[model samples]
Every structure is written in C-alpha cells, then in structure tokens.
Target: MGYNTFHTEGDMEVEVEVEEADQSASSGMAKQAVVENVALANALVKDGGYSWTSPSSLKLYPIIMLITLNTAMNGYDGSLMSSMNAMPAFHDYFNVGKQGPATGLLFAIYTVGQLIGSLFAAPAADRLGRRFGMCSGAFFIVIGTIIQATSKDIGQFMGGRFLIGFGVTVGCTSGPIYVVEVSPPSMRGLFGGLYYSFGYCAGALVASWTCYGTGKMLGDWSWRIPVIIQAFPAAIIFCTVWLLPESPRWQIANGQREKARSFFVEYHGNGNEDSAIVNLQMEEIERETNYDKELANNRWWDYRPLFSTRDRCFRMYLLILVGVFNKFVGGAVISYYLPVILDNIGIKSANEQLLINALNVVFSSVASVFGCFYVDKFGRRNLYLWGALLTGLCYIPMNVIAALAEGHVAKGTGYAFVAFIYLYGIFFSFCWMPLQTLYPAEILPNDIRAQGFAFQELMNGLASFINTYATPIALQRIGWRTYTIFLVLHFIYLGMLWWSIVETKGRSLEELEEIFSDPHPVKKSLEKHKIVLATGQGVKRKPSSNVNDDGFGNGCLNPRNKESLEKHKIVLATGQQSKWE
Candidate 1:
C-alpha cells in the first residue's frame, strides 16, 4: 500500500510514513480518550482552535454539500412533473389528461423505481462504501435523465423515471448516514439538516424556475428542458464524490483505527492529536466500534437486530413515522400535483399556476434555510409540533376555500386558497425538509443504519407511491374532499410528533444510548447531556457520584457499564471472523 505522511507536533516537520487504508481494518487493538482531568473536561474546548471558519472546516463542508445534493435528484423530478401539470405542450405531446390514471402512472413510476432501488440500498451503502453508493446513484440518475429527456413515447419516459427512482434511492440512502457520520457533533443538526434543506430545495428551486423559463417556449422543449435539468446535481456529485473521504466511523468499524486517527488529527484536531474535539469523537467511535462487533456475526443481510429489543421497536416506529409522514401528509400531493390542485381553484392560466409554484418553492426554500440553521437551536420536537399544527390547520381553510370556489371563478376564494398553500408550504418545509433524514440517521445505531434505512425507505416508497398514484384520482373524483385524508394525517402526525420525536440536539451519536435505553425516550432525550472526557491514558473513569449518575457522567462512552479494555476483548475475539466482505 502507498503511504501518506503527516507530523505529530515534533520540533521538525517530520513526515512519518502512514499506510493508506483504502479498505477495511483488521487490527484487534483499540484507542481510548487521553484527557485525564475529568473535572477540567467541560472547559477543554477552547473557542480558538475549533473555529467553524478554520481551514479544516472549509475543506470539509464542500464535500458534504456535494454528497448531500443527491436529494435534489428527486426534488427536481417532482418539480418537473408539477410544473408540467400547468404546461399545455407537455399534455398535448404526451396525449394524456392532466388528472387521471395516465398522469398518475407518469408521476408514480418514479416512486416504483424508488421501491425497487431500495432493495439494494443497504448493500451499496454498507459494502461498497459511501463514495460508491454516491457515485453509482448519481450515474443512474444522469442516465435516467438522458432517457427521459429524449424519450419518443410514454413507455420510454416511464423507463427513465424508473431508473431515476432507483438511482436516487441508492444515492440518497448513503447521504444522510454519511453526512451525520462526518458532521461535527455540536453542529450535527445543522449539517445533517442541510442534506435536504439546501440540496433538496436547491434542486426544487432550479427545477421550478427551469420549468417557468421553458414553459414560455413553443415545442416539446418546454417540459424536456426541466427534465434534462434534473441531471446536473447528480452529474456534479458523480464527478466529485471520489474525492470525498471515507467515514471515520466506517474506517474504525473496518479496523483501520490508525487511518481514522490520522483523519481526526488532521481535520478535526487541527494538527494536534489530543484536541478535546478529536478526543470526544474518538471516544464515541471506539465505543460504537466495539458494539458493532457484537453484530458482526450477523451477516450484512440479516436485519433482525434493528428490532431485537423494545427500544429498537420504538425506533422502528419513529422510522416508519418519518418515512410515511414525509410523503403522506399532503406534502407529496402538493409537490407532484400542485399545478393540478391550483387549476381546480380557478387559477386557469397555465402561466399563473407555474408562477405560483415557482414562488412557493422560493418561499419554502427560505423556511428550509431557517430550519436548517436552527435545527439545533429549536429542539427537533418543538419545530415539528409547531410545523405540523400550522400546516395541518391550513389544510382545513384550504379545503373550505376550494369547496367554496369550485365550478366558478370565485376570485376571492381562489386567492384565499393560494395564500393558505403558501402558509402550508412554508411551515411544512421548515420542519419536515430538515428532519426527514436527519432524525432517523442520528437515532439509528451505526451497526443497523443501513438496515434501518432500508426499512425506512420501504415505508417512504410505499407512502410516496400511495400519494403519487391516488392523489390525482382522489382529486378528480372528490374535488376538494381529497384533502380531508391529510387533515386526518395532520392530527395523527401532530400527536406522534409530541409523543415520539426525541430531541437529539447537543448529543454525540454514542451518547444517544441514554435516550433510547430509558423507557421514556422523549424525557430522557431532553435532559442535559453529560460525558466523561479522557486526556491520554485512562480507560474509564467511574463517575464521582453514583446516586445521581445518568450514564452521561460515567467517563465511558460504552452503552454497557464496562471499562474500555473489557470492551476491546469482545472486538478482539470477533474482529477477525466478523468481516463485512
């Protein structure tokens, strides 16, 4: 193997040769935190070396943004279809009604691809590595875009949509997990939320505007323009993803601890091997790496560990809710069929409908940005509850307005309905856009993250399929009454938001054990997090007080109450035979 070298703070800039870990690790040894001053742990982080604007952070953020943009692949597709609903040229060329089985199939086929693509999502993410999943997914989307844009017939168009769906699922399946894996623990919420808040919205923004710009044209180019535009984000990702680093946690899991340590030292520790920031991360990764061995015997294909316990079951419930709610609560309907919905309310000019859709994307993007930055500021549950309530309540007013405006150009009611839509869009994007992937990625154990997401995407694909297929049919048959279903979802989702969404703000990935292990996760998640930091040598520090200990203060990051060396005993016994490949 080729060697790369870096200094470890000697007098001279000595370049020590380090073996490159292009693949898995097999070492049985483990590293522990170095901080020995337990009392001085809380003050260890000086604002100086860990500046967010440091060169280390600058080099890191762009790679994350590139991988995260895979989300835009689907967002762009949705924008294209919704914009097409308002385009006469697309309907005329395709020879299909704006709201019927034909239109439903056209829109829903993308989700069919997602469902099928989901089958391989775990394999790609777990075995091939994040870069592989990202690069391959991007390739599929680009190819799918080519087929769809140049298609001569409906069958051709459907084939393209299927490929796009499959590609995006494979692509997106790794993105959130990878982003969360690499993000700074304190800023995990911000970076993770940006996966959708920025990437998905950026895709939506481009597509909506591209549609508006092309809709003014005279030929088949109007719809084809935006369809082709869907290729850009994935293309960019495909080209740049190989330059991205492998996840440090994945490196450790594979036993490349030295390589993982080097990354933490250079990027996270800022040339120092023992920065508090790097130490904390190493502490978390090492502990989780231990538990991951317990799961090593279970082949990558076995998913039983995801639901092997009651806590795991609650996590499964939360995953299902995130997946289903992402699409079912009227969001997907608005996303893919907004033009159709607007047409029903006397917004007759196709141009006017397209304009409204474009503006809504812009408006929602602003809310998404706000949500992204403040995700850690406002606890996940708080924002979700408020958004669910506000957006859900808007549906009732919208249903009432649509009911009053149907069959006649009641300009007043039509405008009122549009206003309500803007309201719903803003609030919905504020919470859901950021939380959809961020919450699930953080809650799931590293061992089962791929399996957990495989399950979540299944639920996501099912809900999306139901909405994409049923909404237009329901809208056509029942007119305004179709929204009543979402009103019901709104209520149920609001209750679940209050009961289920755990606040993960300011907690490390390994630290979340305290939250999930307690019977009352919501309550447990809310408590202030405590952790014992090691300087250079201690394996574990017994908490000074046992009566008030909540696991956070127990100097050990392990979920179990064992010293660090004891944990490595399990890894040593199983590490060699428990290979993923």
Candidate 2:
C-alpha cells in the first residue's frame, strides 16, 4: 500500500495519508459499528509506521444516558416552581400573591443560589473527579429538597429553592463537561444536544404533568409532593455515579495515566489495547495535556488566556451572549411564569393553564429530539441564526393578536396567543435548546473547559435572576408588550450569532485549539480546519538516546530514530478483498 504524509509538528515529522479501500481483520461487533457511521471508514491513521483503527460509538450509550439524568434533575426544578405558583394552596401557604414583585424575588432567589454554587463548581471539578463533583451536587439537592417539602414559611421555602439551585449549578455545569470529554468526536453534537436539551425538556414535561395531577388535590400536599419528587433523580445519581466510569480525559489530566489507559481500552476500545482509534485518542489527549502542563499554572489566574487575544476574547463574548440570551429572549418568561403569560392572554382557569403548559413542554421536548438529529449535520451557525429568526418572527403576530384582543378587535384571539406560545416553544427547541447546552462546552479548550463552563453558569444565573425577577413586574404592568422587547432582542441575537459564531461540527477537540488560536478566528477557522481534515493523521516521534557534544542529552521535539521507526512501519498488503493481518 502507498501513503502520503503531512508534517504535523515542526520539521522532523512525516504524515502519510493512505486510502487502501480495504477491510480490516476485525471482530463482528467492530465491523458492524464501522458499517453504521460511514465517516469512521476514512479515519485510519499510521502510528510509527503501523496502521491503527478507530473505536466504536456503541459503547458510549449507557453512560451518556445516565449522566443526562443530572441535567433533567436541574430542568425539573426549573419548571416545578413555575407550576407550583399556579396552585392557590401554595399561594395561601406561602402567603404570596401570584402576580407581584415579591413572587418574582421568591423565584429569583433560586438563581442567586445557582450563582453562588457556580463559584465553586470549577474548583470542585478540577480538584475532584467528574463523578465526585456530580455526586456532591446531588447530595446537596437532597438536603434542599427535604427543606422545601417541609417548609412552613415563605422564607423556608425560598431557602429550599436556593439549595436546589445551588446544587443544580454544580451538576449542570459539570455534567456537560463530562459528556463532552467522554463522547466520541463524530457523535459529540448529537449526544450533548440530546442529553442536555432534550433531557431537560423531558424533565420539564414531567414537572408540568405532575403539578397538574397534584394541583387537583385538597391541601399543601399538592405543591409539597412535586417539591419532594425533585430529590429522586438526585438520589439516583448519587447512588449509582460511583459505579460509572470517570471521565477518561480527567483521569489523564490528574496523572492517573494507567487508569486512563485502562478505561480507554476497556470502555472506549472494548478491551482492545492496540486499537488505532484508542491510540489516536490517547495521543491527542496526552499531547494537549502535556502542552497545557508546560505552562505549569494551575491556579484560577490561568484563565487569563481566555481573553488574551482578539479571537479568544470573541469566543468569551459568544459564551457570555449565549448564557444571557438563552434565558432572556423568551425562555425565562415562559418557563418561570407561563401561567402569568396565559393569564394576560385571557386564559383565566388555572387548571386549563397548567394542562396547556404540560402539553407545551411535551411538544417542545419532541421538537428538541428532531433538532438533535441534525445539530451536527446542519452545523451550529445555521441553527442559531435561523432558530432565532423564526422564534422572533413568531412573536410579532403573538403580540399583535394579544394587543388587538384587548380592544375587542377580533374573537378567539386568546387561543391565537396560546398557539403562538406553543409555536415559540417549538422554534426555541429547534434552534436554541440544543445549541445553548452544547456550544459553551464545545467552544472552550480542555485546560479551561471546567472553568469556562463555570463562567457560563455565572452568566446564566445572573441573566436568569434578572429575567425571572423582572418578568412578573413587566407582565403585571405592560402585559403583552413585554414580548416586543424579546422580539427586538432576538433580532440582535440573530445578527450577532450570524456574524461572530464559529462552526464546530465534526472537528476533533484538539483541532479546535488551532482554530481558536489563529489571529483571525472567524475567517480562518474554516480554512485552518481544512488542513486538519486533509491530513487525517496524527504523528508522534519516538524518544532518542543520542548524547550531544556539550555533555547534554540530544532531546529534540521530533526525535529521529531510524531503526525504531522502520521496525514500527508495518504495511498493509491488500488482496482481492483487502483486510488487515
């Protein structure tokens, strides 16, 4: 077989691109996986002149599904309070009216707790393992849930909300990092989007229906039951997290090299230590990890590089914008006070509002699933821009219909406003939900992934707090005109995303470093990525034993060991049906 090479490191390097069009001697299970995702066929690499194969994605399903429960736990808490606010029993017990500034503070305090928790999320994840951070968060949620369930006063209930928000901050921030690091490069978008977005929406769906069922009950048990149910997911995560594999990338970063290798082989490689995919993944991780360590700065101050350059600063801006707009545009108002929004649109019955809210979440969850299928396929830029555009356009008619309904200009305008609300959820799910969950983790580098995510959580909490706190006052005063503000803001968000957001689909995490490091990131990202895609080979030089004239070892970045390198070179001789020996 013949192969072409591209120089990856400095000078002393070779990159061979070989298209053998041959089948490898592989197990049935491995071969089956290769047939599924066609992109895996072209990902062959040569290490030390030896051929290597990639790993199967089938092994990733169990852990990805399990970790998503954490995100759903956060989502459940987010919507539960909104649903609870609809019940008269809850209002009577808390002694707070449904539509007022005091009600907004009660809701906003949870976001304050999340903001405080975000301050510690990075340190916890960086020092302890991903599993430990997640379990700790889960434990806190259980404590908070018990307090809320038994709360006798408004202050006690608000305290419970704070704890749940704080605990959820830890889980939501770390959970995505864990998923992104462990997932295969080809499937990161789908898995990340599905678990974070679709999973969260599913939890919201459950909360809506649960409140509907319990709201019909006679006493405080109506709201108390939903508050208590929040603990179940956290408990499941706390109990079973220990059994799951820790993030392989985190293991390697913390100097647990052998453990990292072992897990990569057993879980990612399916017991094949010599698998080409496993070796390439390990090599990339090692190289990046070592490069980051070369700086030797492990303190919180190390994150200064995230804004050292124009490109880096732009990325940070996108992240902050993502956090802010995700909550503010329409989601915060709809999610935190849907009953109030419906009330303004003339849907007077609380039960009717709760049932419609349940259906709205179900539809949004279903739409999120559809978006997940093509998030990677269509790329991030298109989804963000178009999703924002469509969602914004939906509001124009909604605002007009609601405004005209007040003047008795048309009959059944209330139902029209409700339809637009459901449509808004659908559009938001299609565009914003998946990307909001996936982009922050995707854009940040490995060394600062946890820290960057912490910043995002901080912004998310601040924005949610502001929006949740101010939404009730706005709804109480201006009514449907509050939508016009979001409508205008969506256009602003759409323009910024179109102009600044970089596409990250189908690229390796390591490759992204090069893209963002370039001076003209928005312009050069696509161009630089072409080089990475063209080579499709990752090369590392073996260490040499030569001594120099100055009595120092000749340590080169790309070592030249002719004998060892030739020994490592094993060719693929293809027959009528090409296969590896």
Candidate 3:
C-alpha cells in the first residue's frame, strides 16, 4: 500500500502526482468495496478532479444520482395519485370521489406515516450510517410497493401508502445529508439541488406518462401498474446503494478514520493521497467532530446542544423556516391536487389532465436544471428572494383567472389558467424545489444535521398533510376561491424569505459554522469573501471573489486546534491505513 503524508495545517500548499493500484489483504465485502472504489477513482477522478467529466467526479455523480431517487419516489407518488384521481377506472375500483373526505384520508395517511417515520430517521441515519438509513428506507418502499400493487382492499392499500410514505421520509432525510458531505464544496448546491430538481421531475414525468397509458385500461390494472412501478427506483436503491462509498465525514466522526482517509484520497483527490484540498477538509472534519463530541459530554441526548447558544437557536429557527416554508408555500396544491385544480377551471378530460401533468413536469424539470446549475452563481438567498417574488406574484393572476373562468366559461380562460399554472410551476421549480434539500443540508451542523433533516421531514409532512387533506374539501366547498388562501401564503412566504434566509453559495460545511456564529448570520453570509479554499493553489482555480484569509493567503482565518493540538491527536501512518481509534 502507498499513501502520501498530508501536512494540511500549513501556509505552503503541497501537491503531488499520484498513481495507486492497491488491493489489500481484505476479502469479501470490504475488499470488494475497496477494489470497486479504486476502479471508480481511476475511471472518474484522475483526468480532472473538478471537471464534471473527471474520473473521480464521474464516480461521485452516479452516487448522487442514485440517491436522488429518494426524492423521485415522492414525486412519483404525487403525480401518480393525481393522475389516478382523474382516472375513471381508478375511481370505480377504489369507490373514491375526487373531492371529499375519502381522498383526504387516503392522501393524508401518507403524510401521517412520514411524521411517524421522521421520529426514527434521525437515529437510523446517525447510528447505522447514511447508506444503511437510505437502504432501510428503500427496503420499506419495496415492501410497500408490493402491497400497494397487490392490494385487495382499501385497508391494505392505505397500509401500503403509509409504509411508502415512511420510507420516503427516511430516504429523503439521509440522502441529502450524504450528498452534502460527499459533493465538491463549490458545486454542493448543484448536486444537492439535483435531489428535488431533476430527480423529482424525472419521477413525475414517468408517473404521469404511466398513468396516461394506463388510463386507457378497463380494469384495476390501470392504477395497479403505476403503483407497482413505484418499486422500480426503490428496488434499485435497496439493492445497489450499499455498493457506494459511505460519507467520509460520517466515517471520520464514527471512528472509521482510515476508510474516511481512503475515500478522500481516492474520490476527492483522484487517488492522490496528499491532495491539499482533501486534507484541509479532513482536518476540519476531525477538528469539529471532536469539539462537538466533547461539548456534548456533559449531558447526552438531552437536546440542549441544539439550543445551547443563541447562534444554534438561530440555526434552529432557520431549519424551521426551511422545513415549514417548503410545504406551506403551496407547492403541494399543485403537486398532488393539480388534476382537481384543472377541473375547476374547465379542463375535465382525464387524458388531457395526465398529458398536461407530464408536460408540466417536463417544463418544471427544465427550470430545475437551470436553477441547479446557476444556484451557486446566483446564491441561495438571492434565488429564494426572486423565486418568492415571482411565484408569489403569480398566485394573484391565477386566483383572478380561476375566479373568472369558474366552470370553463370560455377556451381563453382555460388557456390563460394553464399558462399561469405553468409559470407558477416553473418559478417554484426554479427556486424552492431545488433548495428544499440543499439549503437545509448546508445550514444544519453535522451534529444535528441528520436530526434536523428529520425535523424538516416532520414539518414537511405536517404541512403537506394539511394541504393534501384540506385541498379536496376546500376545492369542493369554496370552488375557485381556494386559490386565495395559497395566494396569501405566498405573500407571507416572500416576506419571511426576505427576512431570514442566508446565502450558503460559496462556503464549505465547516466554513458555515463561523458564519452562523456571527450575531447576524444573514449579513455575514451575504459577504462576498469566505474561507472555503475550494480552488486556487494546487486545485483547479480560486473563487472569483477574493478570499479574506489569515495573511498567509491559504485562508486559515480561524486557526482551529490551537489550544487542543497537544491534547487531541490525529494519528497518521505511512504505507498502511491509519485508523483513528
């Protein structure tokens, strides 16, 4: 075995060319993982570390892509359920009406299951590891999909929906966390955004088309087919997810230091063990991980650390803001209930509704992809502000048009409503959908990040439950007037977006800690200069905005471990894997 020594905490940057073909003494699962990772590193990471086409980067992308399916499954459910509601065969089979308590209970149960699952997702992610948590979630979905497809009664069908919902919460909670820890710091937004962006869109696209094809069927197969196919992504996740490398940060914090180091070397450094960028991140991970652990020694699992200081409590507030705003902004109204919404504005044909749903997903996907790429450039805070402004404003016109065109008075009204809905969908996809997982992953600290995601899922589930359960009844009772409520919500969301959201565009996981530490995190986060050290030196290139650093120009602004350097040691070994324990 060959490994390079990393002198990470220094002014001078060390760059070394690397070539490694190590196949250690290990056998079976562990050895297979090592060999596979080496192939992935050489094939994906070697050519250009930062480039999307780079060997290691390509290797990393597939991992992110697979995990994106977590969000895709949720999208699949939303689009599938909406299409099913429009299907005559489905309505006949289930004996459920479009607008009533029956649809509400069926839909609300999923969110209820998500709430229950949120309670366990954090512990699963933290204790068993991110990959395991994701896999466990996928496993439940596989079972749920089987049950849902084979359901002989409403009870069984609802039971399956609950399981699927629970599974989605768990997968969603951990998958984004894994992406954040593994993604390249500068491009974290793009990869993180992919979760609910193209991922969700892809799922929606498939489900809508599937429903359109099945809507022509004469029997229960119409709904069963879509429900059965829900297992496709979940099955893939359950079977293949373990083959991917675990989060290196998770490994380091949990005492698998050698494996963590190898991941950084192979994946992050393209097999160059001494990669400066990789080492800096590893050092920071070790530093903060230990400090957080020590800080919690006084009282374990009391939940005090989250509210231990003003800064942390502020982070909590941000978490709540993100969690609640994501669902409350009325995206749920479009997601699961769009078919019914279309009916109010005079488009009653099931086929047309399914087709429009498919197209809407496609256009929204385009918007999400655009947002995913430009997110780091425009910044999270700016996107939220603009996205809120546009999407919020869209609701006013939508409400006016819906009210005027109630019962499909004219073709022009229907066309106009579609156009407004498209704009609303496009703008929401451009902003909130992409950031739903990305922003929370960035803002939450490592210690509470997993639980924070669970909290996010809880808030998301609660809000979505309220929306899904109330939408049908409200649409039936208030007619076109239901649009007024979400319109009002968009206004409140816009105000909150302007007030509290912070810019997480150009910073690393550790760098965000300092920003949050400031009295005004939003103000500090908006500053151009940050300490990510994402590029320059031996890496691809420096951040375009100049860095504010500690005179050495290497950006060691907050020199950590100055006091505990002697007390806490990171044992490094040459020619062999170094396990921290």
Judging by TM-score against the true structure, name the best candidate: 1
The per-candidate count of clashes, in order, stands at 9, 7, 7
Model 1 TM-score (2 dp): 0.85
**Model 2 misplacement above 4 A:** 1-58, 300-305, 407-411, 528-581
- TM-scores for every candidate against the unseen true structure: 0.85, 0.82, 0.84
Q: After superposition, how far is residue 474 of candidate 3 from its true place, in Å?
A: 1.3
Best first by TM-score, ranked: 1, 3, 2
Per residue, candidate 3 scores C-alpha lDDT tens digits across 152-182 of 8888999999999999999989989999999
Q: Native-vs-model 2 lDDT?
A: 0.71
Better of 1 and 2 by lDDT: 1
Top lDDT prediction, candidate number: 1
* Cα lDDT, all candidates: 0.73, 0.71, 0.73
Residue 533's lDDT in candidate 2: 17
